[model samples]
Target: MVQSDSKLHEVALQKLNDRGVELKEIAELVYDLQSPYLAELTMQPCLESVKAVIRKREVQNAILTGIELDVLTEEGKLSSPLQEIIEEDESLYGIDEILALSIVNVYGSIGFTNYGFLDKTKPKLIKRLDDHTHSNKTHTFLDDIVGAIAAAAASRLAHDNPGISKIMK
Candidate 1:
């Protein structure tokens, strides 16, 4: 990574930390999601995989954009009608997932499958973010975005380890 890329990643990581999202939380989610498929899995690889995925400019942009939207919704800064839609996290508001898919799409088709599973299962921080949406707090897009990051990282992990033959679909 270049100096500017490193700076961007640092800024993005700071933004995530500001929003109460931890790299370790994301790394743990990756491990939990991919552990079953690997005969020998460790948190170090999972953590590194998450770092690799987030290092991408595309993923950084997604994280910043999604988290900003959630912050806007939480602060009631968004304009009416749309604000209501996002604050409520309506079923029709799918842009969050759309932005998140940009991150998943980086890895390949397998990332899509992993994303689908994590989104459906809402494991770890995903479940926390989803539950937070019900309160005065808002995580309209963060949950889905984080899930995509984890899913993408898991896919990267599978791709890196040559011994793993059958990844669960």
Candidate 2:
């Protein structure tokens, strides 16, 4: 049976795909985060966790909202102050982080720490996304959103595995 929100989920997935973010990329971030804790870890569970996090309605909404803003910024569609703040990804303009926190909040406390670590480390694909010099596209929101996804996915994996879940706590 299809959930009524399946369309939203598909769009969320598509938006990330359109932005050139593959599930495998986020899964790699997940694998990196959980590996030290889980020596026997495999990419399959990390990929599964990323998929499950993206499947959430909350995550879908954040993906849609953030991507829309980035697209608008790229097209120069937003107004002066707001556009500049997002385009430059100003340090003081923390609204992007706040939006990201919403996604992290879904998985409870563990996600917050995980998100912090990823945000600071900018591991793997996230580093590429956040690199302003590499691309003209402004990932102002996408960077944080992508980080949140990886963090939340890692948190989900930790929660699912009782042994590491405690270590996470």
Candidate 3:
């Protein structure tokens, strides 16, 4: 039997693939964008950083936070003031993106650019996740966020090692 962690990885990969993002593409993008500063760290080290973000429960927390907000909104449990606050997806509450930023920070400025592009593009699963906000489901946002984090983390892995791209291809 696959370990729970490995199973999670597999699920994450499936979610990412479903949205049209491939591990190879992500890896190629990372490899192509490497700079002198980032190059010094080596791909494995960078990958470790990305993995750490996932392993450390940071990604899990982001998912939970987003989902909880959705739950509050759906249940009509949020007071007017609180509802107004979360509705904005406010600049101050950028902790989700910030947590994501940690993964990219491993590669310096390039990672930031990559994250921005991914976040804005909402390519594949990301787009589906944003759409899921309208649906009634448990952990809707959280499930998608977990998938997104996995994709981002996987992409970081590919970026660190070009060889991984070849295998995926």
Candidate order, TM-score descending: 2, 1, 3
Off by over 4 Å in 2: 1-3, 164-169
Whole-model lDDT values for every prediction? 0.87, 0.91, 0.50
Poorly placed runs, candidate 1 (over 4 Å): 1-3, 133-135, 166-169
Model 3 per-residue lDDT tens digits across residues 30-111: 3333433243434554445445545544453454455566667667678986665545454465555654565445445645
> Which 10-residue window of candidate 3 scores lowest in summed lDDT?
28-37
Give lDDT tens digits, candidate 1, residues 2-115: 448788899889988887788889999888878888867889889999999999999998988888888888888999998998888887889988999999999888899989
lDDT of model 2 at position 108: 83
TM-score of each: 0.91, 0.93, 0.48
Which is the better candidate, 1 or 2, if ranked by lDDT?
A: 2
RMSD of every prediction: 3.0, 2.9, 8.3
lDDT of candidate model 3 versus the reference: 0.50
Ranking by lDDT: 2, 1, 3
Worst 10 residues of 2 by lDDT: 160-169
Which candidate do you rate higher for lDDT, 1 or 3? 1
